[model samples]
Target chain A: MSRREQAKEENRARIRASAERIIRTEGIDKLTMRRLAEDAGVSLRTPYNLFGSKTDVLIALLEGAGFDPGDALALRDEQLVMEQLFATLDHIEAFFDSDEKFYREVYGGIMSSAHPDVRSTNVERVVAMCQELMTHAAAKNELQIDTNTRELGRYLGVQLLAVLGMWGAEFLSNQESIRQVRRAWCGILLQHCSNASHRAVDAAYQSVALTGS
Target chain B: MSRREQAKEENRARIRASAERIIRTEGIDKLTMRRLAEDAGVSLRTPYNLFGSKTDVLIALLEGAGFDPGDALALRDEQLVMEQLFATLDHIEAFFDSDEKFYREVYGGIMSSAHPDVRSTNVERVVAMCQELMTHAAAKNELQIDTNTRELGRYLGVQLLAVLGMWGAEFLSNQESIRQVRRAWCGILLQHCSNASHRAVDAAYQSVALTGS
Candidate 1:
């Protein structure tokens, strides 16, 4: 890489670290571009030049904190589609539990923000991830042949977003949030599961229902 | 009907009407207690005495605008449980559609507000309504014997709130929001349905899937 590129990368890293610190300690409301630039020892224009807006900065922070759809998709080969979906939920719960305060502050801020970009970025990523999973399941004949995997994925994505929103808003604990997601996802998948996959999905659904008690 | 009691009722109606006008013409943020009292031509203390807080005032406005669980419950005797559930969703969609601007402003404001009361009130009301419907379904052997209606109700409530939140935020069209809710609700209901109602629920599911195409 060029020296200039290396410097840019280092500067971006510094800014992200500063953002995390500010958001964690002071809350998202305090992490303005000016404050971030001053805290990161960069010019005011540096943040705007790099990230464009506060919403973009928050999105960057989220991505930097390991909010990757790739991680969820990686389980595709190792587990059944239903199990992989549940595992994805587990991963999300673990991600939030890893730093409850940080995730809550970032995610809650994005959820409540009037800026549509951040929320759409999050939703679109999840929808793509779900679509990929559903496509794989359909390939294996686990899902009905006629299933509109994209719409099904979109449905689940919105539901998952809601559960996460509740958790982000402190309405549900990490465990409860994950449990609800699992139960609801299992229930929805049960309706779409082909005969070959119905038992597996139903088993997961029963487990969620039992444990939820 | 003592005159004093009747006068208090009249005052509340006037204050509620004034709150609606302000919230409708201006945004929810502009409908402060002081502004409401001034607009209503009542003493400032009148609003405070009548409603505990701004959140309470918003809730009153919502209730006054036909946001009633009883409306959903009234369908119990006239229709099957699954149909009644979907009809309830229709009722909600119609309620929101009736005054898109007002509902959007009030619900969007409450959803984004840090105050927990408004969101919880909305969720709790839906949860109770769902539980009642599920109980009625179980009574007719439409649902599994051991289904936890309360938890199921809560799950559906959160999902509904999420869809409504998306609609209120303008991320979804009114028709699209209701369609998504109906589709997801059908899928979830299909899982808890017994042999007696599986065909009916699956039929509803198929209709939603077909129309969604």
Candidate 2:
């Protein structure tokens, strides 16, 4: 990149880092442009010039920190569907648990905004991740999938997002949310699966319970 | 009530009304204590004195305008479980659709807060409403619930709230969210019910399809 472009990118990163720190320490309500500019050691107008608004800065942070399911996708060939699903959930949980404050701040920021672009992009990412998992299940014949697995994937994605939101907001504890996910996946979702898939899911659930994960 | 207490109540109502108007017209991002005070024709600190915070005012608006479900509950003896469920949903949709902007603002406010008291109260209200519906369904033997109806009620309530949040955030259209709820109630939920209940649910689904709702 050119020197000017590189400088602009560096400036943007500094602003985002400052925004993240503010949100983690002071909550989303404190993530103002003035506070962000002061923390980043930039003029007040610099934030407006770079991000346009506080919501814009938040959207930029989320887009930058968003996770990719590449590793989870890689495990599809070697693992049972339930095992793969839980592993994916664990991966997701770890990402959020790594910085609970930051996750809560980002989630709160996303939920607070009425901007359709931001909201739709977040939901779309969840749908895409679940679709990858469902695609693997269909290829392995792990589920009967009477209806379109894509649609099922969408539903599952929404359910997980709801659980994540509940957990982030402290309406449900981490363990409680994980248990809810297990019940929905095993008790409810398995109903639509093949007999073999049902057996596999049941076995997986039992194994997890025995291991106390 | 004493005259002083009556005036205090009136002043509180005016502040709330002004908050609602500001949120509906300008969105939640524009809602500040200063703006609210000016709009309400009160002192700068009046909003903080009455509601404590912006979220507190928003929560009050939601609690005030939230659906009562009293009308649907009263129809317990006159309608099938599916009929009553849909009626309750219709009531909720009407309340939301009456002013989509206001509904979105209030919902966004509720979702963004991590305050345990507010989050728990919002969820508990949903659980209580759904439990009442489930109790009526059980009393009339409309469905045979294998698990605790309260647990089932909690799941249904959470699912509905998820849909409401999605709809308010514009991630899902009204029709699409309603269809999702219908699928959950009939397709997934009925699995835990009796065969006779399954037949009833299927019949209800078909009847609704025929009516093109």
Among all candidates shown, the one with the greatest lDDT: 1
Q: Chain B alone: TM-score in each candidate?
A: 0.89, 0.80
Interface RMSD after interface superposition, each candidate: 3.1, 7.1
For model 2, residues A1-213, the per-residue Cα lDDT tens digits are 999989878889999999988887787778888999999999999889988778778868865786554455354466777577777777766776777667766766765564667557767877877767777777777767453677767766766766666675666655556655555555445455666577767764553331211
TM-score of every model versus the real structure: 0.86, 0.72
Candidate 2 lDDT over B1-213, as tens digits, reads 999889878878998899888887887778888999999999988888888877788878866776565454454665576567766766766777787767776776766654657667777877787777776666666656444567666666766766666665667766666655555555435545555456656764443231211
Q: Highest TM-score among the candidates is held by which one?
A: 1
| Model 2: pairs clashing at backbone N, Cα or C within 3 Å | none
* Residue-wise C-alpha lDDT for candidate 1, range B1-213, written one tens digit per residue: 999989889989999999888887887779888999999899999999998778788778888877975676654575678777777777888888888878888877777766787677767777777777777787888888777777777777766777777877766767777877776667677767899888878876776672222
Q: Which pairs clash in model 1?
A: none
* lDDT (0 to 1) per candidate: 0.78, 0.68
